[model samples]
Target: MSETIIAKRYAQALFHIGQERSKLEEFESELRTLQEVLRNNQALYSFLQHPRITLDQKKQLVNESFQSFSKEVIHTLNLLLDRHREEILSAMVDQFLTLMNETKGIADAKVYSVRALSEGEKKRISKTFAPKVGKQTLNITNYVDRSLIGGLRVRIGNRIFDGSVSGKLDRIERELVSNK
Candidate 1:
């Protein structure tokens, strides 16, 4: 099976467990930390992926490194390591976070503006866009991009709502070209 499929399956299982334990948010946070650790440490990831590393050693390392995580989270990591599927850890965490967000009626958004947005502006954007996307709220990550010229461009999932000055100018240009 494909990696994504496998990841989704694992995520679904973990999500169900989290739901049962009423610790979905905690699990998500731990999973994000695990993903971050893997992303920031090449040597550790390589060690996990190395074929010569014994399964027990990998499990012991994971246990030592993530001693503070919940039993479920550690168990999941060990399970992945046992199966030699450590490469899919990030994908699984992503899928798990997606599931958790969907369950909580939240969407992750990226908002690009010419300058950093104030908290009030972020709240306003979240309020305006969330309903349109069938989500209760958006977890917005703001990015400053001078190329935007002005206004904001919001991305949720695969859709982008471009309201920037540059975007408007591009649209006008396209229209003028098409009219000719």
Candidate 2:
């Protein structure tokens, strides 16, 4: 199977376990924390992925590093390590969070603007765009793009709603060229 399929399967299994234990949010938080730790700590991530290190040593290190984590998460980590699929850890966490957000009627959105957006602007964008995408709400991540000129470009999943001045100019240019 492909790595994405494997990651999705693992994520589904974890999500199911969380549902059964009534710890969906907790598991999500833990997975996010694990993802962040792996991203921020190259040494630890490298150590876990090192072929020279034994599985027992890796498990011990994980246990020591995340002593406060629940057994379900720790066991899942050990399972992944034993299966030598540590590289998919981040992908699995992403899939898990996606599943969680979908269940809660939330969509992750990226908004690009010429300048940083205020909280009110973010909320307005979310309110205006979420319904069009069939999501109850959006978790917006704002990015400043100097090339945008003005207005905002919002991306949710695979769909992009481009309202920037540059985008409008490009569209108009294309239309003029095509009509000639």
Query: How do the residues 52-171 of candidate 2 rate in per-residue lDDT, one tens digit apiece?
Result: 999999999999998888899889889999899998888899999999999999999999999999999999999999999999999999999989999999999999999999999999
Estimated TM-score for each candidate = 0.93, 0.98
Candidate 1, residue 105: the lDDT equals 97
True-vs-predicted CA distance for residue 73, candidate 1, Å: 1.4
All-Cα superposition RMSD per candidate: 1.4, 0.8
Q: Estimate the TM-score for candidate 2.
A: 0.98
**TM-score of model number 1:** 0.93
